[model samples]
Target chain A: MKNNNKKKIKIPKGSNILEGSRAVALTVANIEPDVVSAYPITPQTHIVEDLAKFKADGKASYEYVRAESEFAAASIVVGASATGVRTYSATSSQGLLLMTEVIFNMAGLRLPIVLTIANRGVSSPITIWNDHQDAMTVRDAGWLMFFAENHQEAVAQHLLAYKLAETLNIPAMVNIDGFILTHSYEPVIIPTKAQIKKYLPKYSPTKGSYLNPKEPMTMGSFARPAYYQEIRQSLQDDLSNSIDLIEKEYKKLQKTLGKDIATKDSSALIEYYGKKKAKTVIVAMGSVVGTIKEVVDENKEVAVLKLKVIRPFPYKQIIKNLKNAKKIIVIEKAISLGNVGPMASELKSALQGKTPAKIYSIIAGLGGRDITKKKINKIININSQDTNKAIFIS
Target chain B: MKEIRVHGRGGQGVVTASEIIAISAFKDGFFSQAFPSFGVERTGAPIEAFARIDTNFIRTREQIYNPDIVIILDASLLGSEAVKSGVNNNTKILINTTLNPQEIIKKYPNLKNKQNSLLTIDATGIALKILGKNLANTVILGALAKQTEIITLKGLKQAISEKFSEKNQEIVKKNLKAVSIAYDK
Candidate 1:
C-alpha cells in the first residue's frame, strides 16, 4: 500500500466505484468518528448504511446508532459532543426539518456535530429531488451551513468541517446537491486513512458538561426573557466568529496539501472563465459551477464568480471581483420561495450602497431542475434588463 | 492539452472507467486529471465524463473541445445531442457498437473527416453475456486500451483486476476477449 501510491500521476490508477453516499461514509470512517447516528432517508440512507457497515467491519471504531428520528439523531450527536467526544449524523429534507428544534440546541450548547442535509425539496406535495428549502428552513439554527460544489467538495468539506466544528465548538451542516451530487458518480481523491489522521488532529472537545448522575449538570435551563436574549446574542457572536476558525482549519489543510480550498482563503469571491476582459459575469456554485466555466470558455469574455463559501457571504470580495462587469447575473440552484435565487438576493446585499452594476436573477435547478451549459449561455445572451425580473426554471 | 471524453449513462461505471484510465496513465508515468461532469439527471440519464493525460500536470480545468479521442461506453448515446457538441477535424471517436467504424462515421458527417477508431464491440452485449448485467465499463475499457495504445495491455488488465469482483474476473476475461475482437474487427 505504501509504494502503490508512488505510481505515475497521469495514468488513471485504481478506482472504487462509489455513489455520493459511499463517498460520505468513507470520509466519516476515515475521520474515525466517536459517535454516528442518523435516520434513513432516500439518498441519505446509503450514507448511514455505509457507516453502520464500517462500524461492523471494525475498520473503524465508533458507537453507531440507528436513531428513531432525525430529532433524536441530532440530539444524540449533541449529547455525545458534550461528553468531549467527536460525533456526526446526517438527514435529508423531511428528516432535517424534524431535527430543526435540536439543531439550535446543539449550537447553543456548542456541540461539534457534523451532519448532512442532502438538500432535498421540502414539500406539502412531496418531492424527493433537490432543493435548499430543507436547509434554508433551519438556516438560522445557528449551525454553520456549507454547500458542496460537487461530491469531491462534499467529501473534502466533511474532513474540514469536523476540524472547523471542533475548533469553534459549533456544529456544521453540509448541504449536498440531493440526487445530483449524491447519486452521481465522480472521481474523488479521498485522503488516505493515515493522511486524514495526520491532517485532522483528533477532535478534542475543550468544554465538557454532561448530564449524568456522577457529573450532573444542566445543559439547557429555563432562563428569563432578558437572559435568553443575552445567551442567543452570545451564540450569534460565536457563530459569526467561527468564520475565522473555519478559515484557520482550511489554511492548515492547504499547508498540508499545497492547493488552496475554494471554501477557504482568497477563493471566497466566486470564479470566472474565458477572457478576463469580459463585460459580463455570472455567479453560482455546486456542480453547475462546472457548466458555467464551460460556457464562459465557449463564449469568450464571459466570466463567473463561483461561490464556495456561502456562510460568510464574502461581501467585499463579491463587490471587488465584479466591479468592472457590465452585467452581474446571480444564478441559484434553490429559489427563495417568493423572491429570486439565493445568490440573487445575496448579490443585492453585496452590491448595496455601492456603484451598482446591472444585476440579474436566474433561478433554476430547484428540486434538481436541469440547468445545462447551453441554458447558461442563453441566459448570458438575454438583454441586460431582463435580469431585473426573476427568470424561473432556467 | 489533450482532451478525452467518456460517454455513458448513470450507474454504468463510466465515472469509474475514466478514473481507472486516468490512474493507469499516471501509473505509466504521465500527468493526468479525471472528473465527472455530474449532470443533475438521475440514474440511466445520459452523462459525460472527461480526463486529461499528458507528460506534465494539467492546467486547463475546462471540458474537452477538439478532443484527441472520445470513448463511448454506450453506443445508444449516439442519438443524444451532446454527442455532436465537439467533433472536429482531429477527433477520434471510439464507439461501442456492432456497426462498422466507417459506417458509423459515415452517418455522422461531422466525425467523418476525422479518424473514427470506432471499436464495433457490443460491449454492453458482452458485459451482459459475461457479467449477467449491463456493466459495459470493463468491455469498453479493454477496447480503449487496444485502440489508443496509450497504456500497456498488462496495465489495463491490472487496473480492471483491481476493481472487479471475483465473478467479474471471468467477466473481465470475456470483456478483454471482446476488446481483442473489437480491435481486430
Candidate 2:
C-alpha cells in the first residue's frame, strides 16, 4: 500500500543567497501551481528559465508551456485558469504592454491567476533595465498590486499573493524592480513545504465560479451601458473589500514564517521605519525602500513610509502616517509624462485636505541608474524647502 | 562590508563568477549579493559584475564606485578606461596574465606609481592545462579566496561543486583541481 503520509520531503531551511528572479521562481514551484506558461524576456528571463529547469529536473510537478509571445502567454494562463486550475505567467516592459488586452480580460473575468511583473522601463531608445513604469501602466487594470522591497519580501509576497488571489478570486500582480531586485542576489529564508501546505491548501475553486462542461456559462460578455457601470462598480467594490482578507492573510503569514512583517495597523498596507515623530518623511516603494531605510536609520529627523500594497492605495493610512511631518518627499522611478510622478500625484490626492505638509516630488533611478546613499542624502538636504515642480535627479 | 568588482568579456563567465563568490560567502555564514551591470550583452563585449560580502544584511543596490578588490579575468581589458575608473590607491588588483606584474606595470607607465597592490597569475596557462578550456573564472576565484580570505578555499570548492554538479560531475573534479593549483600559485 502507498502511504502518502509517511513520505518525507526535506525543505530548505536557514538562509541562502539567491537572485530575486530565481528566488521568486523557486517559491512558485514550491507552491505547486497547475500550469506555468511564459515567454522569455530579459531581466525576467532567469525566472522562467529556472522554473523550466525545475520542471525538467522533476523537482516540481506542473505543466510547463513555452508560449510564442507575451500575448499568447497571458492568454494561455487565462484559459488554464478558466478550467479551474492555478496558473502563472511573467513579463516585463514591452512584453507586458503586449499582454495588456489579455490582462484586462483576465481581471474582468475574475480569474484567480497570479502574474509576476519584473518591472522595467518602457522603451523608445531600448533599455533593458529597472524601473516601475511598466507596472504603472496597468495600475488600474483591476489587479491587486504589491511591490517588494527586497528579495525576502519578493519571496514572501509571492506566497502571500497566491493565497490572497485564491481567497478573493481576484488576479494578483507581484512587482519586483527589474535588475535592481530581479538580478541582484541576497539572502532569503525559504519556508518548508510543510508550512506552505498548512497555509495554502490544494486549489479548489469557489462553489459555482469555476467553469464546467456540464454546466456551461459565458463570462466576460459585452454588456450594455447600464450593466457595464454596475459590473465595473462590483469589481471596484470587491477590490476595496479585499483589504480585510489581505490583512488576515498577512497575519497568517507572519505566524507561519515566525517573523514580524505586518504593520501595526489593522490594515497591513503601510510599513513605517525610523522615528514615529520624524518631521520629514520619505515615501517610496520596491527596492528603493532599502536605500531610504538606510538613510532613515542614520538620520534622526527623517523617516520612511514604504507602501507594500499600492493598488488599494491605503489612503487613510498614508494620511495618518505623514500628517505630522512638515516635509513629505515622494521619490519614484516612473513619472506620468507632462504631469507629476504617478505615486506623487496619488500622495497629493491622499493628503488633499488632511495634512499641511509640503510635498516634493523627486524622480530617481530610472533606466537602471544607481540610487546611492549619498544621492538620497543630497535629496534630503536640498529639498528641505518647498518646490512646485518635480525635481529630476540626474 | 567588502565590495569586489570583476571585469571580463561577455562569454568569459563574469556574471557566474560573481554568483559563485556570493554563494561561497553565504556558505561561510556571511550575507552576500552579486549582480551584473545592466548592459547590452553581446559576446566579446566588455562586461562588469559586482559582489558584496558583509557580516550583516546589505541594503544598498548602487554600483560599486570604489571597490576594495578588482579581478580582471581578461588581460586584454586592461587597456580600457573603464578598467581603471573605480580603482583607488588602496585597491588590490588581481590580473590574469602571462607576464609578471612588474613587467606589465613597466609597459603601462600609468600604473607605475599607483599606491595599489598588483598581483598577476597565468590563469589561462593553468585552465588550459587542467580543464582543457580557457575558463579562468574558477582559477581566479581561487586566487581571490587566497588574497582576500573573505571566503575559504573549501567554501569556494563546495560552491563550485554545487554549481557544476548540475551539468557534469567530471567537470566538477577538474574545476576543483584548478582552484587548488591557482591557490598554490
TM-scores for every predicted model: 0.77, 0.94
lDDT of 2 by residue, A260-293 (tens): 2221234457788889968989999998888788
In the range B1-185, model 1's lDDT, one tens digit per residue, is 45678888888877777766766565555556665665333688887777776654443344565567788877778756687677765666777777776877677655555543454567777767766787777677666676676655566666566545345566667656655554444
lDDT of 1 by residue, A321-372 (tens): 7888878887876667777776788788778767457788877777655676
Candidate 2 chain B, run of 10 with poorest lDDT = B107-116
> Candidate 2, chain A: TM-score?
0.93
Each model's backbone clash number: 23, 0
Which candidate achieves the best lDDT against the true structure? 2
True-vs-predicted CA distance for residue B162, candidate 2, Å: 1.6
DockQ score for candidate 2: 0.44
How is the predicted docking of candidate 2 categorized under the CAPRI scheme? acceptable
Model 2, residue A391: displacement in angstroms? 1.7
The lDDT values for all models are: 0.70, 0.84
